[model samples]
Target chain A: MSVSANDNAAKVSVRGVLAKYSVLIAFAAIVIFFAIASPTFLTPANLFNVLVNNVVMLAIVALGLTIVISSGGIDLSVGVSVDMASMIFVMLLAVGYSGVVGVAGGLGAALIVGILNAIMITRLNISPFLATLGVLFIGQSTQQLATSGGQPIYLTSGYAADQFNAIARTALFGMPTPVIVLIVLVVAVHVLLHRSVFGRYVQAMGAQPGVAWYSGIRVPRELSMVHVLCALLAGVTGILLSATVKSYVPLSGNAFLLDAIGATFIGTTLSRERKPSVIGTLLGVLLLAIVKNGLLLVGWNFYWQQVGIGVLVFLVLAASFGLRRVAH
Target chain B: MSASVLHTEVAVSDEKQAAAKSAGRRFGALVVRLGAIAAFAAIMAYFVIFAPGFTSTFNLINVVEQSAILGVLAYGMTSVIIGGGSDVTEGGIDLSIAANMGLCAAVYATLLSMGYGDFLSVLAAIAVGMAVGALNALAVVGLGILPLLATLAVLNVAAGMELTLTQNTVVGASSPLLGVLVSGSFLGISALAWALIVFSAIMIVVVHRTSFGLRLYAVGGHPEAARAAGISVPFYVSFTYVLSGFCAAVASILTVSRLSASTPGSGELLLSVLAAALLGTVFSRRFVPTMGGTLLSVLFIGLLANGFQLLNVSSYWVNGVQGALILLVVAITSFARGSEGSR
Candidate 1:
């Protein structure tokens, strides 16, 4: 009888551990599978390429989304902010503006979207999901109007272009500039979300708004500030994206929207209370980026890669939640 | 005696103030309830005066016909939103509906291109939609995933499957049945418009008159109460998704019939569908989504698009205008309700 009881306890502990760390385990397993399946996957060059090219922009966007999700709101217009920034940045440079001016314009455009979202959510009493969705639609139309039926704006070989590209291309401390930017933003967000008073208030509000309100957290003002901060982070990504590609492709920023949402949600599995965290979001971005790159290297078609990613997301969440159910 | 008289005077004034406040609220509610219809009428007036060719019967019929597919899709979304109940984060949306429509169309076209019988292909396409819906239901109801994320996963998977099956190319279908669906008119109305009418009729009966719909509304409006009353909340919620899937399948058939081809990225109608369904809420004083409201909202959007084209006012402005209109309508609706509207 005692032996059986001991065995049951061991099983319970195993399930508990699995439930808590399923995302990390699945991520590791995917990495190992890719490394074994593709000879080029383990190389430093390929890994660096993944970090700099595929991961940084998505990481920045997901990090921003992480803030909104942490604040108990969803920002479907992250793509709108991203597109606005890139569009304004490219347009400014095309019109003989300097790189600094273009970057400021880009960030400013993104900030407008955030401000609009804040107003709708806080003042007008619109739900975050609906407000952001409305912004997304309006943003798309605005882009189309500006570009005359959604045409791409190419910035090929100019002083401003070269200067803009340097934001992404320049290396700092043996790391690419964008990657360095991503790391700094991640650390700042981590400190903001995890180690600061404001972060605590945000989390408290998210966890229980009624409680936070009674406790005097100044819910509406803080929520507005959170959205603005989130938009700024997405703007940084937009600038980086335009710099890397050297063009502003209308509606291209929307491609990151779904993936960023997926990554942030996947990252939530890493938290004990299932809150969004910066480190967790970064890891989630890394996992998705690696899978995307590995699948390409492994000769999977684009459609199949999407299927693979969807299945992987479902499985990771299922594993974590399902095991938690069993453990309870 | 003087003190008592002073207190009585204060109470009488408070009662009068309360009565006046309630009367004002009643007037606000009336305005909010009429907001959507008034906007529709106003926009129609503007187009009739400003846009040439907008008042033609042919153009009006064309707008209604164009609204058919979106109408059907919006009705399905309305049911899901209603089932989702009061919480925005709950199971109120099916983001994969557009993707499901694309995949179903692809399936139908691919099967016909492979020399399959028309009836068989249609059935197979519908089956695929049902399967996708079942998968979504299993993930959301059975496994307890957030409705948004679960539908999003299904969207990616469905879209990818569609792209894979079509090899990222358009697939054409040619058949007599499809021809009738696209061009055959009865009583001066297109068959597509007829389909919308039939679907709307069915939705009205199912959602407003049937026990199933009552249970669904119950589940959405108050899950705890519904559960206490012995309603299977999960079953009803799952059924909404399945119904949405079925609607998408029906819309796909019409889409293929009209275009004569299944193209990649037909899922771009997602935002429009969402907008129509969301806009439906403004028609109700309580801000509840209804099939009637959704059908009207779809027509409103269709008319706007048609008028914009006639006026040559840059078709790009339609989406922005639609977004702005939804915000304004919902804002007014919520504002009229005061503190209760904040949710």
Candidate 2:
């Protein structure tokens, strides 16, 4: 009987495997298609350049978003959180802080913001949606009031700091540091989510929180931890953004939140499962980035890559999950 | 749990015995929501005593003129929220609204400047805003995407288009006071104030005295129950957005009339409009959007903005205060108290 049950499980697993890989398969096809379309697209230089410039910070932000989403929560403030971090980082640099100190301070600020989001949701019991939205507003306001004049900060000297610049500039075998960082972080987070005890707790909480709690899980604490990690990742993105642009804008993160959320949700359709897959999210982000890249390469007249992302997210959602439950 | 069950039975018995009394109390609680307006009035009264030019016809007229567009947008938002959807879903923040209105103003002005007819240019602006709002609704309700995420995406799209087209400048108005009277009033009343009074009365009549208003409340209160009652969930959801778009269009026109030049990318004001709409919800004891509540909320915000300006407050302070006020309202209404619902 045990052998028979195992065999049944194996069959189910195999089906799951196929469903999960469909999105990756599409992604592989995209890379190959892009490679054929533009000779320069797959060259090591462009590959590394895009990875370093277009992708890494977003990947980190996406990772945080994934955790929140998996637990059935969301953070509309990630973009604003990143903006606040950039402002703080720039201000620190301007005030004569070392590169290490500035980056650390910026990330710490973001972490606090993240925790606040968690507190609002878990402690005060505000719906995650409304709470984060309020945070988003507060964050934008922070950027406006952080400086007396509400101007974007310039990290004049920090940009030239080799150590800081290395975030975007350093490469392993002609691959950028961001790509290396993304790979390492993804692999680590994947293991943390899938292979650890905490991982099991998270999934259980997401699938059924009350049941999980009755069965001996401290759900709120675990969820709060997830919230913190999201903010930390967004904060890191802020630092990376400054390194790439050599300056900071107040609202830079505003453009990334929805696109990352959309990409994350779209990625889930690939794995075709109840739970989000790290690998699937990576593929989704890649697909979205490439689509935007392709649009730019072909000189598409539509200026709202973000808007296209919003619409694409809708398509993905309709195909994967039905609209938020109706009365029935 | 057992004691509460007994209490529930007892409460039910008591409720049946005093239905009329209970309903009267409920109505009284609703009237209390009007206290916010009194609070605003008191604040304004203080300003009148302390701040210079606080009661001047010119400044009073300007305040009415300034709030007209925001008031209109709040009306659209209240409709959506009454149906239980959050306004922020359609990029419903004041900032987005202001930015969109600004862009429309710029688009109309530029076209008119380029020899396009006023009517044609105005139509184009309306079309653009409606299309954007519809796209937002379809993505969220039809496509199963999150509202906030979808709307912000449109926000970017709108922003990008505005920048590309306007090169970031004001458009539309060639006159110093083309539609200023739309905001001005007669017989010691600002026209804009009068417009709101009329709008609120009409909307109140539509929502409270019509089948549509009843359906809207039912939809918001319980979607499954509403569906069971045979309401078209998706249609109403989409229709609300279309209405919202229509409001944005009218508001944009009024905004252009006020600016005499459309400031490109002014839709960012949607954030404030959204806040006002949400605040209006709390003012109704029912926690549903009432036309009177929305109008009052607009007036409240308009008064606050006017008071700040009169008192020499900074714009940054204005934003912080605005954000704080919204957060407070969200907090107050977040859980809804233990009081039995009218349903």
Candidate 3:
């Protein structure tokens, strides 16, 4: 009986490890598959282009979402919040602020939106769904109607501050600034999520808030911090996006909503028991970037790309969890 | 004797005041809901009387026909919400409905134009639609992913499939069904309105009569409790989505008949339809997606849209206005829902 029990325990441990590793394996597979399908996919220039072009700010927003999802919550309003950031950033620059202030102002507006989300989610105990939905309406409409009577606003003057433009177009040590920014964010989040005691508390709070409460953690305040950080990251995402596109559009953030959620959920399934992890989320985002970059390079039909992403999200998540019984 | 009589009269008047207060609260809520409906009616009436051709048979038919798609989609969304899940996955629904219409139009138009039977095309579209709905159900139920996220992914896939199949847009079926579906009026009402009325009637009955309806409300109200009580939450959730899928297919048929082209961008209509469905919940008590409430929502939006054309203003204003309306409704409804939870 004792021998059998020991064998069972070892089997469970191995299974746990496999479930976690599958997420990374999946990312690796996609990267390799795409590289073979399209030689340019693996090219340094193309990879850099994909990073700098498609997913600078989104990576930041995804990082924030990872934090929120860790707390067992979700945010649909990020798209709108991110969109609002672009408008707020542009409007500030148009008002003739310095580049530093423009960036600050953009981040500041996102923080306010985030705080509102936290309040609605906390004080009112509203589900993140309803709360974010409320903001989605307000944010999208605000973006669309922010200018004079539903007209689109463009910044054709002064390059919206030269330094800001450089952030998007310029590279850090031969790497695109956005990619560099994404790396910095990933490192910062990794440290914050893993090394910080506060991070552990968030996990505890999500997995079992009651127990965390008994352990003397201030749940409300912790949740507020998490939300604020999320919004701030979203603000940064908006700034990056605006710089890259060289203008702000109301629909700028619309595409990210599903992708972010998909990435996060897919991220959760990556590391352990198909649960949330910092490393897993990063890998998931990378995997998606590869697929997107590869598809664009090869000129795959737009619809097929969407179908592939959908199938991948479902398949990887299922596979990640399915491997939970594996002994090795 | 006089003092006793005075005391009795005072007590009677106090009781009457208490009764009046209670009635006033009830009346206030009713008035608020009705006022929203009335405001929409007033707007429509203003257009009908003031704008040329606003009340003409052609324009009237246009309004009803436009509303049918929104109403059906909204109604479909309501069924899922009633089960306590937001269809938030991609575009948050079985968006293949529009695609279904497009697909049907393609299959039918090709066959008809090529001398194949029109009936086969229609059947093909519907069969594919039902299959699409079932696919959504299978994915959502089988996977423990959130309903909103699950359906959202499916929407993307379906949209992709539709695009690939049609290579973009397709010509509508050769024959228009407007004459048959909407040209024949009953009881002094337009046929489109009558068609909508019949659809709504069936929806209400389906929600109330069968065990399916009961299962839906139960699952939405409290999934764990319902599950513990031996209800199959997954089955109900999947079933409602599948049913909504069929509704979308039917709506697609209607739209193809009216427009003569299966538009690529019709996929986005789900968002507007959902907004209306959510608005209907506000008119309803406690997230109740009542047929009357949904129809009222349709009327409200229809009035606004039709009124816009009459005023000769750009239709873009309607999006901003609709967005505002949605925000306002949710803010108000949530405040109401929140108060109960706060207590």
- Chain B TM-score against the true chain B, each candidate: 0.93, 0.78, 0.80
Residue B206 in candidate 3 has what lDDT?
A: 83
Report the lDDT tens digits of candidate 1 across residue range B1-343. 9999999999999889777777777788888878667888999999999999898988988898899889988987898889877466655788899999999999999999999988999999889988888888888787777778788888988998998899889899987779898889999988988899889999989998999888988998999999999999999999999988998899899899889989888778988898899888777666788888898899999999999999998999998998888788877776787744232
Residue pairs with backbone overlap in model 1: none
- Residue range B236-273, candidate 2, lDDT tens digits: 76766667766777777777676676675475676677
The residue-by-residue lDDT of candidate 3 on A133-183, one tens digit each, is: 667666765665566444555665585747566777777887778788888
Model 3 chain B: lowest-lDDT 10 consecutive positions: B87-96
lDDT, residue A282, model 2: 78
Local distance difference test, candidate 3? 0.70
List the candidate 2 regions with Cα displacement exceeding 4 Å.
A1-37, A158-160, A172-175, A194-216, A271-277, A301-328, B1-50, B55-58, B84-107, B136-164, B167-169, B175-197, B335-343
Order the candidate numbers by DockQ, best to worst: 1, 2, 3
lDDT of 1 at A81: 94
Q: What DockQ does each listed candidate score?
A: 0.68, 0.30, 0.30
* A155: Cα error in model 2, Å: 3.1
How would you class the docking of model 1? medium
